[model samples]
Target: MVSDRIRILFNRIAPVYDQLNTWLSLGQHRIWKQMAVKWSGATVGDSCLDVCCGSGDLALLLAEQVGLPGHVTGLDFATAQLAIAAQRAQARYPKPPLTWLEGDALALPFPDNHFDAITMGYGLRNVTDIPGSLKELYRVLKPSAKAAILDFHRPSNAQIRTLQQWYLEAIVVPAAKQFGLTEEYAYIAPSLDRFPTGTEQITLARQAGFATATHYPIAGGTMGVLVVMKG
Candidate 1:
């Protein structure tokens, strides 16, 4: 039920998702995504997966890292988002080794030890089952493979947390209001409040059976990347 609501919300915002992201993040999202990809440790000709790949930003980044002969599967629950991702790929690469699929994060549809590397951008917070999702990621990753999961986070610093809340309520929500998405964007604050901290995430990752888990705080704790490896 919760997943359905989130899926519908994403589908509704698919058209303006990228544009709003660019505006909201002041174009820093691209750099953050690149950092996630690099941390993913995806190499040339490697099989990669981007879970909850929303419009394919991380997936496209992974595609570039894993060039020809490498395959990238972008999985998202919203068909509209997947459609946009496919369209974007077609325009950018003549024969980009990319495939977009509509799927769920908690139960990824792939074999064990399948992908060389995996990435998820702004996705971990939205998943209904964080630990389960992490387990699925660990299952699909090859031995010694890494998965980089990136998302918004609640800053541990009090001052930064206040600023983040201010930005969300003041700048983000208002801008989203202009696009008739005030409610959609407003959920971010509460979600962040409910999201696990970097330390908690590391604990969860280990519990999910990852061999090693590291949570790197980014953007002054407003963002983070949880890099987990399979044994």
Candidate 2:
């Protein structure tokens, strides 16, 4: 299903994934991702993990924020994406202390309570086992650490939901086609459709043993950020 399709799509588009993201979001994704990092309350010396770290955008940003004293690990299952991420990391910031690992979200290859903060951008919905992935995230995050998840939202309001659907179905897919990524982009709507809404994600976070779970709807609820604090 989506799990297989996503793996294939990302592997194929890894080289151009970051460029497509900027074009797709009109460069606003950077702002949204930065906001997600800021909302996590990550400090200068925090150890951070960026799961499903496509092209290492969030990882690089977190590394810059944490400075040389802190550690940042970006994990992704796709080798192609990881290659691109490594190239970008080396080209712009040579000798960065950040680590990029090829790993799965369901079973992270890290010790328990290892990371001070964990962030996932537009990735949770694609996980085959959403709840299981959340549990793994909670297990690795240290007590009082924050996990921020940012992804496309299914708007609860009727009018806004309709518009969001139109944008995804009509605009996004078509635009991606022009960029020679129509097949890859076609997965967007279905993925978002299967993803939980803001409220449901908050509840899932709580069920996964998060002490404090909060949801923020951005861009008029067309996208959402779920912030969960580990106990």
Candidate 3:
């Protein structure tokens, strides 16, 4: 499946993933990730999971927010990504003890109703089965737990779509090319096209058995966060 291609592309780009993210987002990605974590409703003592935690940006933030009494797990399918995450976690302090695991998003290894909250950034679009991934997310979170999934959105407005395309080509591709990951980064446009819209994400979340779900658009509609709560 083409999902395998996405996995491979991520592996190829893993080394520069964090840097490129900062560059491409004009350093706004960090704030966006924090917003997702905040929307997850995780607290200082809450156990949390960051699924598809590429290079562990969101995971690291979770670690910081959850404090020492909490546990934070950063799970990704790519060892290259997880390795960087592990390295970063080692130097961080006063944060939750972080665990970096190489695992599939579709079939998480955690027990049922295990985590108090969950956050995922820039990963929902690449999943092979969106609904299946949501189901897995639902299965792992405790009752009344919250989750926030942040990702790119295909802007519906023609002007915004044009601007997105221009930025992708002019900024994202050029920056990625500097790291020799142009091919890897080029998949974004197509991926965004295939990604479900904000409204659709809420529909899928509800169908996956979440008690509450809302889609929040951000950055002039080029991105969104799907906030869901398990009942």
Candidate 4:
């Protein structure tokens, strides 16, 4: 079960989460998410689902890519985050054929084989049952559909790992404080530490019934993208 404390913490910090993320990653988070979206191979007229969509960044991007004929659903458990995402969607895209729903990742409210493609950005780490969540994603995605996940990874190289630690602890925390989100930012390192590595995530994807899985390292292995396709 997801701890109440973590949910409350995220709801409380939702407003500033996107801003803090940009600061913490020096605005690289957007690039990483965009890369994941591109790797998903979603095309025009494809229906896409973005679980743990957060502020709807990937959802909007995918919607834009899929055009007016396609549909995009952005789902998250945090109301505050969803509210912000709704407001942004209204202000920016106006009538974007996109739906924003407040929901859970492990128990998606969709029927089996519903979506053409699915993407999760910086969300797998926050899930309490990563494998279970992957299975749920697979269940909702149509046969032959693709799923792309982007998240932080523990660097394998000793020197790069050390540098990553320094970057998160030193730069991220302080930058977050500037945005009045020090406590929220402090969660980054520990969360990444607790998260499975890229290789492990690939294995999980396969175990979850993905026909094929691939991992792409970015930022010198500090971040990773896992792409999985259903048989």
Residue-wise C-alpha lDDT for candidate 1, range 108-173, written one tens digit per residue: 989999999999998999999998999999999999999998999888899999999999999999
Prediction 2 global C-alpha lDDT: 0.89
Off by more than 4 A, model 2:
none
User: TM-scores for all candidates?
Assistant: 0.99, 0.96, 0.96, 0.95
Best by lDDT: 1
Candidates in order: C-alpha RMSD to true structure = 0.7, 1.3, 1.2, 1.3
lDDT (CA) for every model shown? 0.94, 0.89, 0.90, 0.89
Look at candidate 4 and give me any clashing residue pairs.
none
As for candidate 2, its clashing pairs are none
Better of 2 and 3 by lDDT: 3
**Residue-by-residue lDDT tens digits, candidate 4, 6-116:** 677678888888877776677988899899899888899999999988888999989887889999999998888889888888987457779999888989999999999
User: Which regions of candidate 4 fall more than 4 Å away from where they truly are?
Assistant: none
Instruction: Kindly state the number of residue pairs that clash in model 4.
Output: 0
* Pairs of residues at least 3 apart in sequence or in different chains that clash in candidate 3: none
Q: How does candidate 3 score on lDDT?
A: 0.90
Write candidate 3's Cα lDDT for 1-231 as tens digits.
776777788888888888778877889999899999999998898899999998888988887788888889999998888888888877766444798898899999989999999999988899999999999999999999999999998787889989999999888888888888888888888788889999999999999999999999899989999999999
Worst 10 residues of 1 by lDDT: 92-101
lDDT of 1 at 131: 89
